[model samples]
Structures are given as structure tokens and as C-alpha cells.
Target: MIELTDNAATELKSIIDKEEKKDHALRIFVAGMGCSGIQYGLALDDDVKEEDVTVESKDIKIVMDSDIVGGLTEAKIDFIDTPQGKGFVIDNPKAASECGSGCQGCQ
Candidate 1:
């Protein structure tokens, strides 16, 4: 239920391969209360509870817990390394206003 870019998948795989302990999947979801309104979060988790929905993106498995603040379907996750630093950039179409990078959900 999600689309992941090549760069994003690669970046995510590298991270998972590093931190994952028991074949855990990378969990990505959006939560309220950010500088704009929503912010993206990423974490390496090993527990996939019953309510979690798992989606395959290339070689990476992303677990989505519907009970979370919201869903991340049809979202592209990218890891960009700038001269300053690096972070996960999310492009979400569900957002309402322009928050980052001239997109609806850029934060």
C-alpha cells in the first residue's frame, strides 16, 4: 500500500541491516504535532503485533500499524544527504498545506 523510491529503499535496507535484531521490519508512520502539523517517524522494530499491516517495498518490509495516528500508504520515503546533514524526507499527498520543499507534506 506504499511506494518507496530506489534511494529510499536502499537507505532503509542499510539501516535495517544495521539495527534490526530479529528480522524486524522498519515502521514508518505519521503523527500529529510538528512544526507544521504532521511529522514522519522511522524506527527499527522487531515486534509485528496482530493489528499491524505489513507491506513489501522492494527488499524491505514496512509494517504499518493502522491504530497509529494515521497511515502512510502511497507515500514515498527518501533519504537525502545534504552538505549540512541527512534525514528522511517524506512526500505525503494526504497533507493539506505546504510544509516543506513546496509540497503538501514536506516536513
Candidate 2:
């Protein structure tokens, strides 16, 4: 249940085309850490674990662990290129804080 902007889809396609692995997918996950408790991660993954989930949108396939699916259903993945360089940008509605949201001892 995630959305990828046109720019993001295009950028991701470009990366996938140039990578050593072509059948892999763009993996996005919520990890425990960041200035704000949880940070978003993006990478290329060749396989999905039993707990992982995936959604296809705008010609892009997004893969995430099923455990994080409920909380991140409406997330948005995008790409941004500037003079500084290029990177992936995430917008998750479920994130209480930018990165460090859940209480350390809690989640």
C-alpha cells in the first residue's frame, strides 16, 4: 500500500538497470534507530523472507517486511537529485517522529 512518485520510479528503474543484479527489488524497511527512534532504509534485495511483503505501483515494485506493513501502509518513496548528490526519500504517515519515534525500551 505504498506510492512511488514518477521521479522515484524512474530513478529506481535506472538503478536497477545498472546494478549487477537485475531481478532484485527495491527494499524499504523501518529499522530501529535515527535521530528521531526509527529510520527508513532503502536497498536492493534479491529475496524476500517469509515475513516480507510487496506492492507494485507505477511500474515499480516495493518490498517490505510484513511485520512493518500495517504501520507503513501509506508510505511514499521518492528520489531526489541535487548538487549534493542523489538519494531516496521516504514519507511515512505512521512515523510519530522523523526517525526515532518508538520508545527505546518499548519497541
Candidate 3:
């Protein structure tokens, strides 16, 4: 299950409220491989595919593809505000020692 911290939920809701797309759900999926093994993508989407898993958080619907569920099962989403900027951060324990695609040194 993916968990969103209070700050993440509020921040995401603010962004979603400003989008032009209405009646759409937030789609969070695994994108290309990252330095940590897997990268995630977030978008405003309305299409719920047959293999998608829908999770509700802070009254918002977050959808993810079924195939990525295992890797992101206990992931946590949080918002961070640093001196440089503010953004969303996904803390995925499963990716602690992950290696991205095309990396030959990681196992």
C-alpha cells in the first residue's frame, strides 16, 4: 500500500485543484529505471485500466499499475521544503540498494 503524508496529500490536492483536467484521478506509476532502481511518474489521468489498482488517500484517488505494486507496496510519499525548492519525495524502502537500468555493476 502506498501511503501519503499529510503534507504530501495537501500539496498534491492543491496542485490537482489548479489543473484544467476535471473528473480525473491521480495516476502514479513506475516510470523508467532510476539510480535507485525504479523511478515513479505522477500525472492527472482519468483512464483506469483493467490492471490498475486504485488507492484512496486524503479523499483523492491514486491509481497505479498492478505490476508495480510489489516494489512499491510500502512506499511513502511526502512533501519537502528545502532552501533550494519544494517538491514531492517518495521514500521507497525497497529501493534502498536498487540499481537503475543499464547499470552493470549492480546486482
Candidate 4:
């Protein structure tokens, strides 16, 4: 299952509250495919497709396409605020290993 770190859940909740998106669910999707297997993206979405898989973690509802769920199983989503940068990151061991260290996306 896709899991969100505590920090990510907090930050996501804050953003949802700030944006007045109480009715929306966090949507994760396959944004693209490169040498790094698949790139995922997140967004607040109110639309839920018939083929979507929905789950609740840390009180946050997350939706993703059924076909992509297997690749993201056991993935963890975290928010980092280091000096270099700050953003949400999905740590998927399977995807990382598949991508290896050669591609720029993997690096």
C-alpha cells in the first residue's frame, strides 16, 4: 500500500486546509515513463474514476489508478525541507532498483 509519512500527511493537510480543498482527495498518478520506470505526481482531485483505487492513510484519502497500484505498493511519501530543497518525495524501493543509478531521473 502507498503510505505517507507523518510530516507529509501534516503538510498535505495544511495545504488542503489553506486551499479550502476539504472535499478533495490526494490523487497520485503515473506522470511519465523514462529510464526511471515511472514518474509519479500528486494533486488535489475531486474526480474519482471507476478504475481508481482509493485508500485512507493518516486520515487523508488518496486515490490512484488501479493499473499503477502494483508498482507503488509499499511506497512511502515524505516531505523534505532541507536547505537544498523542499518537496514531497515518493520513496519506492522497487522503482528505484529498477531505475538503477545511471539515469538522471534516478540520480
The model with the greatest lDDT is 4
Model 2 residue runs over 4 Å out of place are 98-107
lDDT (Cα atoms) of all candidates against the true structure: 0.71, 0.79, 0.82, 0.91
Residue pairs that clash (backbone atoms under 3 angstroms), model 2: 36-100, 37-99, 37-100, 38-99, 38-100
The most accurate candidate by TM-score is: 4
Error of 4 at 84 (Å): 1.2
Candidate 4 residue-wise lDDT at 63: 99
Q: Report clashes for each candidate as comma-separated counts.
A: 0, 5, 0, 0
For candidate 1, the TM-score is 0.75
Question: Residue 101 error for model 1, in Å?
Answer: 22
lDDT, residue 93, model 3: 90
Q: Tens digit of lDDT per residue, candidate 2, span 1-107?
A: 88998999888888888876678888887655655546778888989787788888887777888877787778888888999998888888776764344446545
lDDT of 3 by residue, 12-51 (tens): 7888778855578878877776566778988789899999
TM-scores for candidates 1 onward, in order: 0.75, 0.79, 0.83, 0.88
Model 1 pairs in collision: none
